[model samples]
Target: MPLQAHVVAPSRTAHVLEIIKGAILSGDLAAGSPLVETDLALQLGVSKTPVREALKTLEGTGLVVIRPYLGATVREMSYEDAAAVYDMRLLLEPEAVRRTVAAGGRLSAAERALERAREADGGVARSAANREFHRALYEGCGNPLLVASLDGLRDQTSLVSVAAWARRASWETEAAEHEEILGAAREGRADEAADLVRRHVAAFLDRLPKQDIDPAPPSP
Candidate 1:
C-alpha cells in the first residue's frame, strides 16, 4: 500500500494573499504602491497565476485597486472612505455586540484580544488585536449574514486604522475606550456595551484625516 500524504501546503493563492496582505497592512508595501504580478511572483517564488488571484482577492477586500491600464496598486485612504466604512460599523457593530451580550456569549477571546492590543509595540499589531476584539464582541450574535457584512469591511477598516494611527498617536485613548467597552460587556450591561462600541467607532472616524493618503511612489 502506498503511504498516505498527511501534510500538504495551503493553496498558493492563499499563501500569496497572506504575504501581500501582511506587507500592505504593515506599511512594507505602502499605499498606492504597485502590485506588479511579475515582480511579486519572482520575489515569492511562485507563478503569476497565484499573484493574479491574490491581487483579485485583495481588490475584493478593498485593499487593492485595479485600473484599466494601471494594473493593481494598494488602495489609498481618504476621509470619505473612512466615513463610509465607520458609518457602517457604527450602524452594525454596536447592535451586534448588544445581541451577543444579551445572549451571554463567551468573551474570553475578546479579553485576550484586548490584552494583545495593550501589549502591542506598534500600530500594526494593535490594529490586528483591535479587529479581533471587535470581532469577538460581535461574532456570536447568532446572525451569520450580519457577521459576514462586518467581515467584509474589516480589511478596509484596518487599513484606515493604520493610516489614522500614522496621522495621530492616540492609541492610548482608544485603548482606554476599549477597556470601558469590555468592562460593560463583562458586567452584562448589553445596552451600555453597545453604546460604548458606537462611541469608540465614531471617535475613530472623527479622527480620520480629511485628505487622501496616497501610497508611496511606484517602483521604477
Candidate 2:
C-alpha cells in the first residue's frame, strides 16, 4: 500500500521552520532530542526536503545542531551559554530601546503586545507574548542588522526562559516589567527605557537554574 503524499505549501521551508522552532520553544521537542527529517516531515504533513532545509536554517540560528554523522538535534543551552546570551542582550537591547525612543517610533504595537502578555496564561503563551513585546520595542530601532541579531538571540534563549518560568512562577512580575518599560518608551524617556530593559533582562538572568551551568555537547 502506498502512503498518501502531503501537499506542500509555497512557503514550505518557512512553514517547516516555524513548526520545528515552535515545538522547540514550547518544549514539545525537548533539548537534545533528535530531529529526524523523516519523522518531522511526517508529523508536519510536509516533504522531507523542506524539513531538511529548515533544519539547516535552524542550525544557523543556534537553535538546532547538525553533526556530520549524528544528524540534527535541538541545542541544549547551558548556564554559561545562557549567561553569555543575556550578557550580549544587556549590551544590545538597551541600545535598541534608546534608538527606538530617539526615533520616536510608534509604540502602539508594543502596548498591544503587553496587553496580550498580561492577558495570556502563564507558560508558553505568556512567554511568546513576552517575546513579542520585546520585539515590538526593539524592531523599531531602525537597524535591520541589530533587529535580526536580536531575533536570533531571542529564539536561542527561549529554552532558558521556558525553564525559568517552570521554576519560578514570576509571569506577573515579568508582565509588570514590560508595562514599565513600555510606559517609559511611550513617554520618550530613552534613558529610562534603556535602563528598564537592562534591568528586566538582568532579572531574568538571575532566575536561571544554577545547575544548568555545565555545557553538554549534543550526542553525535
Candidate 3:
C-alpha cells in the first residue's frame, strides 16, 4: 500500500512533485526505476490524479520520461548527457562569475551562501542547499537569461550526481574550490574567478562515475 501524504493542500501536485524529486535526489528512486502512478499514489498517500500531474511535471523537467503505455521511468544519466550539461555550464557560468565580479562586490554574499550550503554537508537537504548557494552566486551576475540557463543546467546536473555526491570526499574539495572562487571574486579579479570556475567545472566533469545508471531493480 502507498504511504499516505502527510498533508492535504490545494498545491497537492506540486507537493507530490517535490516528494518524488527528494526521493530521486536521495537515491530512494534511482534512475530507470519504474514510477507507476498507482504505486506512487499509494506510496505517497495521495490520489492518482495528483501523482499523474506530478509525473507530467517531472517529465517536462527532464527528471523522468513518461512513455505511452510504458508509464514513467526515472531518467538515466549518460556521459553524453552529463557532457552536454557541462558544456552549457562551461559556456555560461564562467561568464556569470566574471560579469558578477565586474559588476560589483559579491564576495560577502558568496561567503554567506557558501556557509549556508555547508550547514547540511552530509544529508539530502544539504545537496539542495548547495545547489541554491551556487545558483545565488551566478544569479548575481546581472544577466537574467544567463542565470536562468545556468539554473536549468544545474538542475539537470544535480539529477545525475546528488545520489552519491554526499558520500564522496570531493564534497570537501568542492567547498575549497568555492572558497577559491570567492577569494578571487573578493579581490575584484573577474578573470581569475572565471579561470577558477572553468577549471573547477572541468575537473568535476572529468571525475564523474562512468556508470551513468544501474539497471538493477528498485529496492523493495
By TM-score, who's the top model here? Answer: 1
Candidate 2 lDDT, 40-136, residue by residue in tens: 8887788789999999999998889999989999898888788988998998999998999989998888888788877876577777878888988
Each model's lDDT: 0.87, 0.82, 0.75
- Compared with the true structure, model 2 gives a TM-score of 0.89
User: Which segments of candidate 1 are over 4 A away from where they belong?
Assistant: 1-9, 212-220
Model 1, CA-based lDDT:
0.87
What is candidate 3's lDDT per residue for 2-120, written digit by digit as tens? Answer: 33465477888888988887777767787788999988887777789998998887887788889998889988877778778888889898889888888874566567778876787
- lDDT per residue for candidate 1 within 1-220, as digits (tens), equals 1111122146778888888888899878877788888888877777888889989999999999999887999888777777889999998999999999999999999999999998999999999999999999999999999999999999998898888778677789999999999999999999999999999999876765575344435599
Candidate 1: TM-score? Answer: 0.91
lDDT of 3: 0.75
Candidate 1 clash pair list: 31-215, 32-215
User: Which pairs clash (backbone N, Cα, C closer than 3 Å) in model 3?
Assistant: 2-42, 2-43, 3-43, 3-45, 4-45, 5-45
Ranking 2 against 3 by lDDT, winner: 2
- In Å, residue 141's CA in model 2 sits off its true spot by 2.0
Clashes of 1: 2
Runs in model 2 deviating more than 4 A are 1-7, 212-220
Instruction: Give the CA lDDT, 0 to 100, for residue 40 in model 3.
Output: 88
Query: Whose lDDT is greatest here?
Result: 1
